[model samples]
Target chain A: MVTVTLNGLSVDLRDRAVLHGISATLRPGELTGIIGPNGAGKSTLVRALLGLIPATRGAVEIDGHDIARMTPKALARLVSYLPQGQALHWPLSVERLVALGRLPGLGPMSRLGADDLAAVHAAMKRADVLHLAGRTATELSGGERARVMLARALAVGAPGLVADEPLAALDPGHQIDVMELLAAEANSGALVVTVLHDLTMAARYCKRLLLVDRGMLVAQGSPQEVLTSDRLRAVYGVTGRIEFGGGSAMVVPLERV
Target chain B: MPEIPVLRARNRALIPLLLLGIALVAIASLMLGAVPIPTARLLDAALGHGDPVVRAILLELRLPRTLVALMVGGMLGLAGAALQGYLRNPLAEPSVLGASNSAALGAVAAIYFGIGDYSPAVLPVLSILAALASLALLFVLAGRAEGPLALILAGIAVSTLAGAGISLALNLSPNPFAAMEIMAWLLGSIENRAMDHVWIALPCIVGGAALLLWDGRALDALSLGEDGARSLGVDLARTRARLLLGVAIGVGGAVAVSGSVGFVGLIVPHLVRPLTDRSPSAVLLPSFLGGAALLTGADILVRLIPTAGELKLGVVTAFLGVPVFLVHLLKERRLW
Candidate 1:
């Protein structure tokens, strides 16, 4: 299991600060939801965590190793990332697309081995895209594409999985399906983190929530402690109430504040 | 998921077929010319046992020309596949992106200024430098943008600028013969080339093609777009640098010897892509072989055609490439 820690992490893009000095510790074997309003620097934070962008200050550590000093291949072997609104540029087969996730583990001249193929098969099965293995990825529907991308990420077999807005184009049923998959992954002893916009899903599915607004970490706790109506009004500009149903909390927005 | 055995088998068969086509075309290239040799005599000459004249023509003249055509064509095709995969654009190629034209401009400058009289090496070295310059400009203009339109526009700017430079050199010639020489060279031909030209181009072409084919896996990961590929451990800045240097060295070496051959790069990948699994990596090797076959076959046709003067190889490739390119534009209009 891997533990990700952020110590006073700040990010600047194009000479403008997008994320302030924020610190948090995220543990494995739990699904943590990062919730924030639009343009709240959620994407920037995730990118910084993966070392896709340089941090203006401070550092991100995984299992006590600073990611700043880690090679891209080493970092990728530990953490898998799924970005938002990915567009397919080629007509690759689904199986081949998923097999690309094994790139971090592959040598420059090595072909895919039996272990790599097995990982691809398991990822496709888990993401429920096994039937689409032979289909061209570019021709799939948006929902099918989302799940296929999820399979591609899963094929990495990294201990930590970070997905940015995985459910944006998904239908409600597929949203629940994706959340359940992340929850199952966490239960199977992986660290699963998702940047979510849906408060209800975040509350119901995630074990803990990190709430941010305007680049600041406003709150971080369980669904009951972090989803307070007053905090929602102050941060999201929406008046909302947390309702208990079936042993979990769900946030329902009443009106714009 | 179970493997699709039929599809897998078909994909595996394509490489051998392509290699067979290249070999047959190479042999035909050796046999057919202004003076045709019978098959039995050709084989005898190949074994160094035929008439001296036949042996000289086969071993010295035809062999070097055939080798140059194959290497130049293979370089074009491999570079095209690599560029298209890296940029995620179907239309990306060395000529279209101005690397070939810039190299041609450099070669023309060397010839026009009489610097080529000093050494045969001056032409290729200067052409490679110029190709490197144009590729640097290409990345400066189009690298940060996300869409194909930006890259295409940048390519147009570079190509037009290089064309203008070439025209300027042609307009102000020292003599009529110099003007004629520039015009003929610009038409792109592999005729009358010797083994010296082959040796000059071979090292750079082989090295550049190695750099391109080495990035096959990185190209496959780039199908996920830049961010996704980066997250998967592809070093984007490094990949870009390697592609630029590779295309420059390869195209510069080719243009140094063959002049401004256009459209072979653009055409071969499109023809070979459908036969593979359609992944960027799967398209590289077949495209290389297909390119070799296409150019060798085209050279043989130029010899066979009954025109008073031999047709230029560039003209033939343009005729073959434009219609296919237009068809792609009409069919995949939504891609941009």
Candidate 2:
């Protein structure tokens, strides 16, 4: 029911332009993977859209309003985001971490209500972290922590999610589980966008792809339409194969010389 | 009655904190003093009682210092908790940003140049101004950096420079006795302090602590990185500025009157965290009371150990603080 539009967005960090005039649209009910090499301005693009850093030349819009104009709680209720690496401040329980998702819905003077509790319980169930709800987050394995963070994000129940490298530290099992979860979210109507380095997972799960080289959006289409070996080699300096059938597709990238 | 996990956890922490805080305040104000004023005697004197001398000692000498130490301790604790919460670093103290050293230098400047002797108000003013300056400098330096550690490191550097400046002021003094007095004062001893000192810092400490408490939610958002916090609707610039101002002035006022009291901020926050469900807001008032308890106890310890020739409150804190900090380091093995 809603969409995100990035228009001529530019970003600078450490006095250098990291994301340059790159534009993309994220549609509803689809898992759009923003794929690229390391330091390809993928995260920068997300940060720029969230109005974290000042855009040099353009703007990002959610639901047809400029993102910068949206209030923080409003934006959070609409679109949730996760960073590449998030460290914990304390050894909070999984449920406590998930409850922070309801912060946007909470008023300044108001405390959490019954709906908040139900939402937190539902999110924990959805992320499959229900068993770990009472356990300390720090005691969990890396994959478990990732799942809890995902649960926290899903707890927001936003219309759109922009997660940067949510699967980086996950095990192979968790990786697929998280991908399937994202796919399920999209299937259920939320627009889930993720920046993934795993070409295999990206190809298998995402409904659409946006490939970038440096700061430019090099290609955008379905898995069969894009993610070709030639484009992969050009952008990533590597070669890859794409296999499609049985309602699934996979891309395996070969080593570069 | 809310049984949500976060609510339950917070509830578990809050009850003990309330009891312990009240107990600490009671023992601090009533029992731990040089004259050993019993609760009954204190109550009678507080109620305008029978013995004139008991009433006078309780009302005049012990009461002012106790209230000042309590207030100053509370301020440092709150300041420390706020700065630590703001940066999400456990090691941050009120003195981290060179505010204490800057205030000490200001106090030394006032004393050395005879400005403090000129007007009763000149001393705290000089200390506050220099502290605010150091805070501004810290902002300029840290604002240019990416990581929070960089800002803390910058604050350490500023602290060292201000410390050296204070040393230079001592060395340049013409009167050796006065120089030594200023030096000892700068080392932070709360002895022979009068009602005048209390009047000077009480308003500033009270006001600054209120400012720090007002931003509890802002501190919570900052737990999310600037980017994530922004998306959640925190105005980063305004939040950072207000906290910095609060930390700087609160610390400056306390240190100006009490000399350079340290570790109250560090120790209080650490001790209060486990008691506050690790919630920054819950930690705020408890940290303040905890700091007051610790520092006032240290002051009382200083008075009790006459054979040690009246040790400085700072020395007692350092002696206790270093061991506690080391134990924490051994346990956590990581920064907050």
Candidate 3:
């Protein structure tokens, strides 16, 4: 597992500043959620960390080294990241699309080796998609596609993962299943940062919640400590009830204030 | 969601049909020609055989022409397949970059100035150089953002201007026979070509095809879109340069010898699509084989069609391809 540290991060997207001077240290083995309403720069912040978008005023260090100079394949192997929109290519079988995750480890002229196959099967199993391996990604339902996307990420088997809105279209059952998958990864000591719109899933699954508004972190703490009703009203402009029930605290978004 | 069994079965069935079509074309190519060479004599000639006249006719003329047709067709087919896969645009072909027109202009320039007759060897050299240079210029003009259609328009513009220049050059030529000569070359008949012409184009075509084969994985990534390919570590600039160079060498050399034959590249790939399991790699080699077969068959048809005069190979391919092109155009319009 590796830590990700963003220092004085500022991002300009096509001449507009999307992220402004945001800084955070993400700990290892933590299922951290970057929770915010739309246009809060959740996606921008993550994109910045991946070094996909150049940070205008700052830099990011992965485990104390600059990410600026790493080769693309090496960076991919070390840190797997999923952006907001999933790429839809050929309507390939789930097994084949997931196998694309093994590309960094394999050379151009080489076929998928035994280790690659095993890891793919394991990753698909981890994402609860073992049964759907033979199915085409395009043919799957939205939630099923989300899980398959998660499985593609899992197939990367990186030390850390940063996924944006991974649960946006998932149904409640798959949402819980996917959250459990993330929690399991963190429990196994991989740093997993997920950007989520569903506060309830974020509250129940992630150990740490980084709440942001207007490109700045408003709160960073445990779900119960950070997801207060007052915080929700101030940051998201929504009314919400944060109550401890059934052994876990749930942040239920009541209504827009 | 459960359209699985049907699609799988269709993919499988298409492969056999494509194979059968290719085989039938190949057999017909060997049998139907000017001499009416029987199968036994054909086999004997192929085996380097008994009658000196039959052996000479088969080995010297028929064999080389058939082989040239196959290779040229293969080159066009594979080139077209690679271009379409790279751009993800169905209309993409090597000619979209003006390689054919540039080659024609180079050959015409050589003939008009009496330079080709001065050194017979200089014609192909001039054609290859001009074609390669035009592709390089196109690479610069289009950059990465221009897709297949953009390339086509740029090529059309270049070709039209070059064609007008050819007309003027031919008109001003002192040799009265120059106009008829240029017209015949422009009409694109693969007649009186021998093993020497085949040898001239073989190395360039094969080398260019090797580069195209290197582009397979990258083309697969490009199907995801440019940004997607970049994310996967594809160096866009290098791939573009390689792609253009391959097109220039293979296509320019082809037009150098055959004089602007159209649609082998376009027709062969589309025809072979059924055999490739809908995979890019499957399309690549099969298109080559299928293209070779189609052109050879067309060449055989040119030989056998019993006209008062000989037929043009280009005319036959165009006749075969026009209906297919129109069908694709109509089908594509309805698809969208």
Top candidate by DockQ: 1
Q: What is candidate 1's TM-score against the reference?
A: 0.95
Give the per-residue Cα lDDT of candidate 3 at B313. Answer: 86
lDDT: worst 10-residue window of model 3 chain A: A83-92
Candidate number of the best TM-score: 1
lDDT by residue (tens digit), candidate 2, B1-336: 224555554656554665476467646655556678777877787888668888877667776777778878889989989888877888788988889999888999988888788776788889988888898889888865645688788889889999999889888898997798797877687676678778888877887887788777666656656666666566667677777788787888898888887778887788777656565656787888778777777777777777646578788888888888778667656423
Q: What is the clash count for each candidate, in the order shown? A: 0, 1, 0
Give the alpha carbon lDDT tens digit for every residue of A30-120 in model 2: 8999899998988887777767777887889887799778777788888887767766665666787777777778755356778888888
The candidate with the higher lDDT, 2 or 3, is: 2
lDDT of 1 by residue, A64-146 (tens): 88999999999999999999986678988888888889999997656887788888889999999989988888888888889
Residue B184, model 2: Cα distance from true site in angstroms: 2.2
Clashing pairs in 3: none
> What C-alpha lDDT do the candidate models reach, one value each?
0.87, 0.79, 0.75
Candidate 1 residue lDDT tens string, B1-336: 566332345477899999999999999999999899889999899788979999999989999999999999999998899889988888788777788889999988988898988977787778877888898899999877654567678878988998899999989988988888888889899998888888989988998888888888889889988778888998877777677678888988899888888888987888888788777888888888898898888888878888977799888888877998778667755434
Instruction: Give residue B283's error in model 1 in angstroms.
Output: 0.9
What are the TM values for chain B, all candidates? 0.91, 0.89, 0.86
Which residue pairs clash in candidate 2? A72-B233
